[model samples]
Target chain A: MTTMDHLAEQTKLERLLQVDEGSLGFVAEQEVQATRAFRQQLSEFYYQRHQDAFHRLAGLSKLLPISASAKLAMNLLGPVLAAGIACELPKDRAAKLAGRLPTDFLAKLSLYLEPSRAGAIIAAVDEDHIVEVARHLIAQQEFITLASFVTVISESTLRRIIQQVGNDGLSLLKVGFYVEEKTALNNVVTLLSEQQRRALFLAADEHSLWPAVLSLLPYLNDTLQGEMSNLAAEGEEQARDKLVRAVAQQGDWYPLLLSWTRMSQENLESSIRLPALHEEALLRECMAQLEKHNLQQALPNFTELLTEEQQALLA
Target chain B: MSSPIETLRQEGLPEQALAYLTALPEEQQQTLAQQVLSTMQKKDERVEKALSRALDVVPAPLRRTVRKMLFS
Candidate 1:
């Protein structure tokens, strides 16, 4: 908006007009930055708008009597949206209203609400209602939605809910792959039974959810982070791309590198056995990425994974 | 399997271009990233040409750069 800002941008544009690959790269970079910034601003604008809408809905929920609200909700809003509206109401009032609602309605509704938004109601309502909701959500295989409450809801509540839901690893696997929140995903994984983690890796590979799971790597405990080498070392292309690319992008490769190093010599040997791992161009590119990121601390792990010829490329 | 942003994310810049947008909160950043990625997937080129023409007051090279940056 300022003259100086305009002039500076104008100068950059002139320089970017050179039309060579480097100039194209610069223009592309600047364009990407501008686009991202615009999108981010739009995202904030819309989020605030939605929050305002929800606040208004909460106010309306307070005005309507329970029977009236339920009828209007059932006929007009549908159960999940009605429950979403109810979630924003005062906890004690929401609890009373929840008690009167059909169990199936409440049960199905949990699948759609953010656990954080529903936290107060989950805590205020009787245990039976909460348990039934969790049961239905888990039974329906809405593991990601169910996992939303993992960090927000009380441990006692989570324990009771999962206990009734059964000990199968499917919930853990589904939650691990599908949950995007960094801390939340890390928590769920760290809490997993060992068997559950294995089941998770297998499910991730089977379903190609490994990319989502890879996003959680940086946030996990160091020991648990080391465990991810096996996930990365999976032979399939989807897993391989997610693995190599994630390591390339992260600031700290120590956890991942160390995981590879800790692999039994045989495991380490077999890691390069994957056809994709053998490609000189990709391996060099991965090495190039590590160098670009300037993570020299990861050298030892890199050294361990590559052949002597490959190690020389880092120089 | 490859997308421009993913390529940019992997090798071009560790700090995502989108990550710099508007300097919003983390939650909004996630939503923005998803929205931008979805929009980018649709690949609208006419918008780029329009933007380029709007900037035609600048030199030809600059005009081309604007169009290429936006659509290519």
Candidate 2:
């Protein structure tokens, strides 16, 4: 058989291995051996029609376990497959190729090539496709790893793509549930515009929002703080304290104190905490300044530096 | 003769006197033994206060173990 014919035969055997069930253990061992042979064949197949070779390789990937298939596809195709896909691969063929590959394999492949190819994949991937793929991966409890891969895409473009997907995009976020989603969303929020960030904050459940806001606090700028303060204004006292604590922890204690000062005297006394001595003397200095200034005039811009424990003490 | 504890305590030994104490000679170690005693005493007292405060905040189920470790 010619080299091309031999490779085609090997690809046929791999496809059979995927569904064959005589003995899983024997098939798994044979598949590994076949994979090594396929790698050698792939090296020679490099000069042939790239699309034909990729179609065969995608077939081979399906025969292996998802993890093994993903690794093999990455090793064999890597940048080359991505480049080929980026160039005028017909849309039907591109979709077919994407459909055949495992979600993890597709995600990894997206990372290998030029940024433009990655962008193309992100743009080409419809919201349903993303949600479907994300849901499948989440069902397998691998969303954390998947989120790490998604973060590899350039942040601005990622934000745009996700925004285009809208509430449907939230399905991907929801797949991982609150804590996991909060970690990932914290990353996504940092990459988003102020408006986009606010939208996400407003969309999240109340319990989820507190932790998400706390995680984002250290990284938030003045604009985000203003948005957060507005959001907190509608929440209950405990929720407001959570926001204040986050602001204080982020080194915006002056603004936090100012916000508290503007509350009715009873509320202010009930909610805000003073700094203890051992917990950074700077906190005490801010407290003294707050005391010195008229409650209405000098409070807004002053920031404090209290540790959480100290703040708890004062509270 | 100044008792070592008295001397160290007078010098604000626990916070500001760590450096000076470490510089003393081996033979002088016995002379400053009481300073070590006073330091331990103060540490024990502070630890007790911290434990009591922690107990007030921590839920009841966790307080017993936390108190044992704190006192010990």
TM-score of each: 0.54, 0.32
**Model 1 C-alpha lDDT per residue in residues A1-315, reported as the tens digit of each score:** 112112223233222121222321222233433643443343333233344344544555565578765554555555544554665678888788878777778766665455546677777888777777777777787665566567666666766765564446456555554443447655565555556566656665566444445445656766667665664464455555555544444433433445554455555555543444455766766555456656546445555766666555444
Interface RMSD of each: 18.3, 34.6
lDDT per residue as tens, model 1, B1-72: 764445335433335354563355555445434444443332223222323333333356555654444334
Top of the candidates by lDDT:
1
Q: How many clashes in each structure?
A: 1, 2
Whole-model lDDT values for every prediction: 0.52, 0.42
Q: Where is model 1 more than 4 Å wrong at Cα?
A: A1-77, A111-116, A139-144, A159-174, A177-180, A228-275, A308-315, B1-72
Model 2 RMSD vs true structure = 27.5
TM-scores of chain B, in order: 0.35, 0.40
**For residues A116-217, could you state the per-residue lDDT of candidate 2 as single tens digits?**
234455445454555555454444544333453453344554455455535432333332222222344454544555454444445443434333343334
